[model samples]
Target: MKPDYELLVRGNNLRLKDDFLGMSNVTLIQGPSGPILFDTGGYISRLGLLKALDARGLKPADIPLVFLSHLHFDHAHNVDLFAHAEFLVSRREWDYVGAPHPDDLLVPWGIREQLSKSRVTLIEGEGQIDRGIGFFPAPGHTPGCFAIELDTERGTTVIAGDAIKYAKEAILRRCDMAFDEIEVGTATIRNILDRADRIMPGHFPELVRLPDGNFVWDEAAPFELMVR
Candidate 1:
């Protein structure tokens, strides 16, 4: 049976509601070949994605491949759920995840060990994963943060994980607390806005379009002016 692609918007994390303007978004893309999951939510809500997939008559095993935007716990904590799937991530991001870091313990040792055993594919630059799907490196949010581009009948949709958190942040070049560097994140967001017509940010809504012929970020009508 041909698989159906869908983006499942899970629960919103309001822990930092007072400080950061960010939420967790989990994407479910069911292609003709198989299903692909993007950025699993935190460990606590890991099964939440599985439940969502179950509702669609799919399971973690049905997902042949999984792409992670980065190694941050919030974005990749539930990766272990798909042990049978080949996990893809940016080469730089993989190294960062494997690297020993005593300062930050957000990523647990068990998760890293599990990842080491899984089928991990490290990608460099832009490359076509399938007929209409492609992966591109969009560092800045993290050293190896990347985005997934899908060509559809509607238009080209870029699933920009953390490279561009919110539509408003992308338009205004606004960096959140999770970004490693502001300048790099800003440049990456600019690169995405320059290429993609519609952007599916990791957080805040599904897709936002770049106003006709506008390459620069617009602060006035940031998130409110999205294409939906």
Candidate 2:
């Protein structure tokens, strides 16, 4: 069994009009080796993210590892703040952003530049970030987007990036835009649903909790999912 761990969520909707102003979620996983940050939010969320960390008796400099779901600015802008952390990013994403097409608005220029910081480990297909925590590709939202697998007291949880931005998007099997093909995005979503009982989505105000416990979304909408 995995040791006792804490998963704290820092989620909110971006009210700004210029960007893809909507729900964004970041997760703080505290385990044996200090704290781990998953997808620190966009350029505008720095203040709130910092404040949230402070509330938990943590400062950005205290973080030692960061797991980036993708290179989207909305999900990866405040990386520099985690002063002592080593970032684990998908090698596919690292290379793609090294020279991305200017047309894909899903990827902005600034966030890609942020990868210049050292100590970044390029994770290939699948690997472990720590004990009972692993990662694998769940692409389509971006050429190299991936999801995190965490073993928790409640069971297994998947931190699916924008691959399944919201539960609504996953339920509908649809996407508004992405770096690659739409079909690929839907497939990635299905894969996550197949593997995890709970999900930490990239842009959802609440987690996509399955099997209905004391989860936040158990009442907002009636939905059904069959697992084989």
TM-score of 2: 0.83
User: Relative to the unseen true structure, what is the C-alpha lDDT of residue 190 in candidate 2, on a scale of 0 to 100?
Assistant: 77
The candidate that wins on lDDT is: 2
Displacement of residue 166 (Cα, Å) in model 2 is 0.6
Itemize residue pairs with steric clashes in candidate 1.
Answer: none
Pairs of residues clashing in candidate 2: none
Candidate 1 structure quality by residue, lDDT tens digits, 118-137? 89888899997777788888
Candidate 1 residue runs with Cα over 4 Å from true position: 1-4, 11-13, 17-23, 100-105, 210-228
Q: TM-score of each candidate? A: 0.81, 0.83
Worst 10 residues of 2 by lDDT: 214-223
